[model samples]
Every structure is written in C-alpha cells, then in structure tokens.
Target: MNAVAGAVQALLVIGGAPLLTGLMRQVRARLEGRAGAGIAQPWRDLRKQFLHKETVRPRGTSEVFRIAPLVLVATSLVVAVVVPFVTTGSAIPPAADLFAVVALLTLGTVALALAGLDTGTAFGGMGASREMTIVALVEPTLLVAIFALSVRVGSTNLSSIVSSTVHDPSRVISPASLLAAVALVVVIIAETGRLPVDNPSTHLELTMVHEAMILEYAGPDLALVELASAMRLSVFLGLLANLFLPWGVATSPDPLSLLIGTGAIVLKVGLLGVALAVGEVFLAKLRLFRVPELLAGSFLLSLLAVASSFFLA
Candidate 1:
C-alpha cells in the first residue's frame, strides 16, 4: 500500500510539473502587462519537442551526455516519492532522511555538470563551473537549514519533521524555524534558476547559467531536460510548501484523506508559484559575482538558525 501510494504521488508530481511551470510563466507574463500563453503551454511545448524526429548529439560527447537527462528526472521522481507531498507519513520512511534527499538532488546536479563538461563547449564549461560553485555553497546551507528544523523533531527524516511540526504548530513560530525558512527560500530561488539567481526565461549568452548547459541539446533530449527541470522546480516548491505549512497533508492511508491531501498540495504549490512570480517581477537578477554574496548571506542565516535551535531548545 505504501508503494502504491508513493507511485500515485510520484505520478502526480511528474505529470503536474509542466503545468506549474506554465502557470508561473502565465502569471509572470500577466504581471508584465502582456498576454500570456495558456497554462497548458509547457505541455504543448514538450509535445512539440517530442514530435521532432531526431536529436543532434554534439561532436565528442559521450553516453553521459545522452543519459544525464534521464538521471535528473529519475532522481527528482525519487525525491517526489519520498518527500511527503500529500502525507505526513512516507512510503519509504528511510529514504525520507533529509541528508539523503539533499544528496540525491546533488547527484542530479553533478550529473548535469559532467554532461555540460562532456560537450567541451565554452558555454557548457562556463555554465557547469558556475553551477558547481553555486551548488557547493547552496548544499551546505540547505543541510544546515534542515538541521535546524531537525533539531526540534530529533530526527532528520522529512516525514518525522513534518509530523512533529504539524502536531505542534508552536514549533513553526520559533526563531530557528523562521530563519531556516528564509534560508531555504533563498536556496530554492537559486536552485530552481529563478530570478535574483538565474532567470528561467532568458537565453542571453552572457547571463545564462542553466540555459548555457543545455544549448547543445535538441529534440527529445531537450524535451526530457526541460521536463526534468520543471519537475525539479515543482519538487522544491512542494517541499517548501508541505514542510513549512503542513496543514492539509494526510496522516492516514484512507482514500478520502489522500484525495483531500492531493487537493491541498496543489493549492499550496499553486499559491507559492503565484507568490514567486510576483516576487520575481519586483526583483532583478543579481550580478554573477554578487551571487556568492547572496548565498553567503543564506549560509549565515542557516547557521544562525542552527544556533538558535540549539540555544533556544
């Protein structure tokens, strides 16, 4: 039953990811006073990409380049299944360890970086270098933030943390919780290639981070990469929503409860998408050099959260 429930939730996340991406694009377009593509546009785009007859592999690229997208999407699906998207209880409880979740995400990033380097293109190398630098900074802060929350629950398991916080909302009000939330929000924006870190909509060669790595990909490869990117974004946003505001997640295995939990997560993630769009509209991307500073600030916040958790406990 746990495996069944997890499979269902993973399917929901993978299927709905492109919709979330489309919705965010539409919201951003409207905010900028332009007519937006329909919320189904990402799905249309993916279909179009898939319909293309061939994928052009760049010269000197290896099997790693061809397989990176699959690795990325697979790792994200694993995260979706283990992250308690619609329930406080996990299908695979041991997989819900916060460190394991972070490691899986890091593995995906590392695979992409290797793929980028495999292309031997200047843009690819540059993007991969920048990405690795960012990840190196982001991962520790991410772990520290999770550590802050875990301290309160006495376990690093995501389901355990969510259950503890949900059962006692007072934990949500603590200094550590607030600090960790802020740090995680910063990490999310950076990790997801959102504005003030990296812009998802731009292909400007000089400014592109994520886009640069995928410039050589086309057709089915591009579709898979794009879908993986969307799913990754959705997973991060869903984690943020359910972890911080776990109000509507199911604690039981009943059908009705799972149905309600599904609806609640969709609403939560949708509202978060809207908020992100609005925030992006008001903020400009930080300078490439300045990005390290911003991440450093997040690291400081995470460290403070850890300190607060220990001292205030």
Candidate 2:
C-alpha cells in the first residue's frame, strides 16, 4: 500500500510537471499582455523535440555525454519520491531529511556540470562555472534554512516537520518559520533557474546557465533533461508547499483522504507555479556578480528567523 501511494505521487508529479511549466509560461505571457501559448505548450514542445533529430556533440565526448540526461532525470525522480504531497506516511519519508534532499540535488548538479565541461565548448564551460559558483552560495543557505526548521520541530525528517506544522497553526507566524519560508522562496527561484536569477526564456547563450549545460543534448536526452527540469520544479515547489503550508496533507492512511489530499496538493503546486511565473515576469535578471549579495541576504534572513524562533519558543 505504501508503494502504491508512492507510485501515485510519482505519476502525479511526472504528469503534472509539464502542465505546471506550461501554466507558468501562460501566466508570464498573460502578465506581459500577450496571449501566450496555452498551458499545454510544454507537452507540444516535448512531442516536437522527440520527433526531431537530436543535436549531437562533436565526436570524442565519450559516454558521459549520453549519460548526463539519465543522471539528471534519475535524481529528480528520486527527489519526487521523497517529497511528500498527499501524506506524511511516505515509504521512504525518512530519506527526506533536509540534508539528504540537498545532497541528491547536488549529485545531479555535479554530473550535469561535468557533462557540460566534457563537451569542450566555451559556452558549456562558462555555464558550468557560473552554475557551480551559484551552488556554492546556495547549498549553505539551504542547509541553514532547513536546520532552523529542524531545530523548531526537533527533527529534520520531513514527516515530523509536517506533523508539527499541521498540528499547530501558531508556528506559521513564528519568526523562524516565516524566515525559512522566505529563504526557501529565494532558493526556489535560484535553484529552479527562474527569473531575476536566470531567465528560462532567453536563447542568447551568453546569458544562459542551465540551458548551456544541455546545449549538446539531443532527442530523448533533451526530453529527459527537460522532463527532469520540470520534475525538479515540481519537487521543490512541493517541498515548499508541504513545509510551509502543511494543513491539507494527510496524516491518515485512508484512501479517500489521500484522494482529497492529492487534489489539494495539485491545486497548491499550480498556484505556486503561477505565482513564481508572475514574479519572474515583473523582475529582470540580477547582475551575475550581485547574485551572491541576494543569497547572502537570504542567509541572514534565515538566520534571523531561526534566532527569533528559538527565543520565542
């Protein structure tokens, strides 16, 4: 039954990812006063990509080039399993410890960066270097934010945090809790390669980060990378949804409640995705050098939130 629940969550994340990406495009387009491609645009894109000839790397790149997409998709699929949407009763919920989740994401990132560098292209190397530099700043903030939450809940295990937050409403207004939420929001934008951090819409290679890493991928490989990206977006947003807004999550094992919980999770994720897109639409990308300053402010806010929570508690 646990496996069954896990499967349901996985499929929901996989299928919902494209839709979420499409919705964001729609939202961004509408906000900019144009009737953008409808919400199913991502699906249409993937189909076209699959049918077309894949862009290949110059010969001598070795198998890592081919394996990069698999690594990216596999890691994201694992993350989807660990993120709780409908229930705290995840089969591998313990694996959702904040540090462990970050590690999984980092592992995938390293593989992508290596693949980018292996391509031996100037653009690929530039993107990988910038991406790693950003990750160096991002990893610490993520840990600090999660550590604050763990201290308050007395456990870093996601299940416990959900229980504590859902059981008590006052925690939401607490300083630490709010700080983590804000920090994670900044992390979400950066980690997901969204606007004001990285623009997903731009084709100019000079401005790209994530796209540069996959510039050599073609066909199903590109599809996997794109799908994995959508999955990553879903996982991060789901984590935020379950972490800060834990009320609708299921504590019960009943199937009916699980069904209702699933619907609630989708609704919450969709709304968050739309809000992020709208935010991206209004903001321009930050100067590459200034990114650290923004992340540093996030770190300070997270620390302050934790300190406030500890004092208040």
Candidate 3:
C-alpha cells in the first residue's frame, strides 16, 4: 500500500512539475500585463524536445556530461518518493530522514556542477563556479532550517516532523518554525535559480548562471535537463508547502484520505506558485556579488531559528 501511494506521489510530481513551471510563467506574464504562454506550454516544449533526433555533444565532453541529467532526475524522483507529499507514511521510511533528503539534493547539485565543468567550456566553468559558490552559502541555512524543525519533533525524520506538527498545530506557531520557514523560502529562491538569485528567463551571458551550464546541451539531453530542473523546483516548493502547512496530508493509508491529500497538496502548491510569481514581479534580480549578502541574511535567520528552538523548548 505504501509502495502504491509512493508511486502515485512520484508520478504526480514528475508529471505536474512542468505544469507548475508553466503556471508560474503564466502568472508572471499576467502580472506584467501580457498574455503568457499557456500553462501546458512546458509540456509541449518537452514533447517537442523529445521528438528531435539530433543531439550535440561537445568535442571534449565525457560521460559525466551525458549522465548528469539522468542522475539529477533520479535523485529528485527519489526525494519525491521519500518526502511526505500525500501521506505521512513514506514508501521508504529510512530514506525519509531530513538530513538524507538534503544530502541527496546536494548530490544532484554536485552532479550538475561536475557536468558543467566536464563540458570544458569557459561558460560552463563559469556557471559551475558561481553555482558552487551559491551552494556553499545556501546549504548551511537549509540544514539549519531543517534542524530547527527537527528539534521540535525530536527527530530528523520528515514523517515524524510532519506528524508532530499535524497532531499538535501549536508547534506551527512557534518562533522557530516561522524563522525556519523564512530561511527556507530564501534558500528555495536561491536554490531554484529564481529571481533575486538567478533569473530563469534570461540567457544573457552576463546574468546567466543556470543557463550558462546548459549551453552545450541539445535535443534529448536538453529535454532531460529541462525536465529535471522543473522537477527540482516542484519538489522544493512541495516540501515547503507540506512542511509548513500539512493540514490536508494523509495521516493514514486509506484511499479516500490519500485522494484528499492529493487534492490538498495540489491546491497548496498551486497557491505557492502563484505567490512566487507575484513576488517575483516586485523584486529585481540581485547583482551576482550581492547574492552572498542575501544568503548570509538567511543564514542568520536560520541560526536564530535554531537558537529559538533550543532555548524556547
């Protein structure tokens, strides 16, 4: 039963990721007073990419360049399975550890960074360097945010954390959880290459971080990378949604509950995507050098969350 539920959850994430991305784009376009691409546009884009038979591999690239997209998608799928998306009881409980989840996500980032370097292009190397620098600053805050929540539940297991908050809603109102949420929000913006960190819509070499790394990829490889990027963003948003507002998640193995949980998560995530779009409109991308300062502020917030959790307990 857990296996079936996990499969359904994973499929939802993989299939709906592009939709969420498209939805965000649509919302942003409307906010900016233009008719945006429809919400199904990403699906269409992926399908078109998959239909193309031509793939271009640079002259000096290695297997790492070819395999990074697969690893990235696989790791994200594993995370979707382990996370309490629709249900509190995961298909793989042991892998549901918060630290393990963070580590798996970090592994995916590392794979992409390596692939960027493997391309042996100046642009790729530049992107990789910038990405790693951001990762170094973002990761500590991410870990501390998780630790703040874990301190409340007495375990780093995601299920335990969700269940504890679900059974006792008071925990959600605590100082630590609020601070952690703020910190995680900042990390998500930076980690997903959103505005104020790296703009996903831009391809200019001067401002591009994620795009620079993928300049050498085409056709199927590009499709895989694009899909994986969407999935990663969706997974991060889902985590933020489920961890902070777990009201409708299934606490049992029942079919009806699972269905309701699915609906709940979709609604919650959709709202989050819209909120992100609205927020992005008011904010301009920060200068590359200024990114560290923003991340540093997040780190301080996470640190305060940790202290609040320990001292307020």
Candidate 4:
C-alpha cells in the first residue's frame, strides 16, 4: 500500500507540475492586467517541444550537456517517490532521510551546473558560476532550517518529520518552526530562481541566471529541462507545504486516505504557487552583488531556528 501511494504521488507531481507552472503564469498575467495564455500553455509548449522540434546539440558540448536534463528529471522523480507529499509513509523508507533528500537535490544542481560549463558559452559559464555560489549558500540553509525541525522530532527522515507535525499541530507555531519556515521560504525562492534572487522570465545577459545556463538547449532536450524545472518547482512547493502544513497528508495507505492526501497536496501546492506569482508581481530582482546578503540573512534565520529549537525546549 505504501508503494501504491508512492506511485500515485509521483504521478500527481509529474502530471500537475506543468499545470502548476501555467497557473502561476496566468496569475501573474491577471495581476499585470493582461489576458494571459490559459493554464494549458505550458503543456502545449512541452508537447510542441517533444513532438515537433528537433534536438540541437551545440558545437563543443560534451555528454554532460546531453545528459543533464535526464539526470535532473530522474532525481526529481526519485524524490517524488520517496518524499511525503501525499502520504507520510514512503515507498522507500530508508531513502527518505532528510539528508538523503537534500543530497539528491544537490546532485541535480551539480549536474546542471556541469552541463552549463560543458556548453563552453560565455553566458553558460557565467550562469554556472553564479548558480554554484547560490547553491553553496542555499543548500546549507536548507539543511540547517530543516535540521531545526528534526531536532525536535528526533529523526531526519522526512516522513517522520511530517508525521510528527501531523500528530502535534502545536509544533507548527513554535518559534523554531516559524523561523525555519521563513528560512526555507527564502531558500526555495533562491534555489528555484524566483524573483528578488533571479528572474525566470528575464534573458538579459547580465542578469539571467537559470536561463543563461540553458540557452544552448533546444527541442527535446529543452523540453526535458523545462519539464524538470517545473517538476522541481512542484517538488519544492510540496516540501514546503508538507513540512509545515501537513494536516491532510495520509498516515495510512487506505484508498480514501490516499484520495484525500492527493487533493490536499494539490490544493496546498496550488495555493502556494499562486501566492508566489502574486508576490513576484511587486518584486524586482535584486542586484547581483546583493544576492549574497539576502542569502546570508536566510542563513542567519536558520541558525536562529536551530538555537531556538534547542534552548526553547
């Protein structure tokens, strides 16, 4: 039953990720007073990329460039199956440790960074360098922020963390939890290349981060990379939702529970995506030099969360 729940959870994320992206775009469009493309636009884009476009391999690129998309999507799929999105129990219990999950995400980041360098383009190299710097800060904050939660729960497994929260709702409002939540939100924004840290829509040579890295990709390869990006957004949103607001996640693998769990997660992540889009409307990307300061602030919050967890207990 745990395996069945994991399969359903994975399908939910893969199928809904594109829709989530489209929804966010539509929300931003509405707020910007434009009649936006419908929520199916991303799906249409992906279909066109996969079926009508030809894969282009740039000159002087290596296998890393060719394989990075696969690696990124593969790791996301693994996390989707192992993490507690719909169910508190995972198909692979041992693999759901918080450190393991964080490591998987970092591995995907490294693969994409290496692929960017493999392209040998000036923009690709610049983006890769910038991305690694962000990763160095973001990853540690992610670990420490979640570590604050684990300190109280007494386990590093994501399932255990969620389950503990589910059974003890009060923990959600604790000083440590609130601090960790803020820290994690910043980490997600930075890691996902959202506004104030990086702009997903921008292609300006001097400011683009994630886009510059993928500028050399086209056709099927581009589709995979885009799909993986959407998946990662959904995965991060799901983690944020489940880790902090895990009320509706299934503690058992019964059919009814699984159904509720699916709906709950979808609703939670959808709301988060909309909120993020709306928030981005008012935010301009921060200067490149100031990004480190923003990330440093998040790191400080995480440290406070950890300290509060120990001292306040």
Sort all candidates by TM-score, best to worst. Answer: 4, 3, 1, 2
Candidate 3: what lDDT?
Answer: 0.91
Error of 3 at 225 (Å): 0.7
Better of 2 and 3 by lDDT: 3
Clash count for each candidate, listed in order shown: 0, 0, 0, 0
lDDT of 2 at 158: 76
Candidate 3 lDDT, tens digit per residue, 1-313?
Answer: 5787789889998899999999999999998999998999999999888896478889978999999999989999999998998988789999999889999999989889899999988999999999999999998999999889999688999989888888988888899999999999999999999998999999899888898888988888899989989988989988998888999999888899999999998899999989998999999999999999999999999999999999997
Worst 10 residues of 1 by lDDT: 1-10
TM-score (C-alpha, index-matched) for candidate 4: 0.99
lDDT of each: 0.91, 0.85, 0.91, 0.94
TM-score of each: 0.98, 0.96, 0.98, 0.99
Tens-digit lDDT track of model 1 for 1-313: 4666688789888899999999999998998999999899999989999895478899889999999998998999999998888888888999999999999999999888899999999999999999998999999999999899999788999999999988998888899999999999999999989999999989898999999899998989889999999988888889888778898888888888888888999999999988998899999999999999999999999999999999998
Give the local distance difference test score of model 2.
0.85
lDDT-based ranking = 4, 3, 1, 2
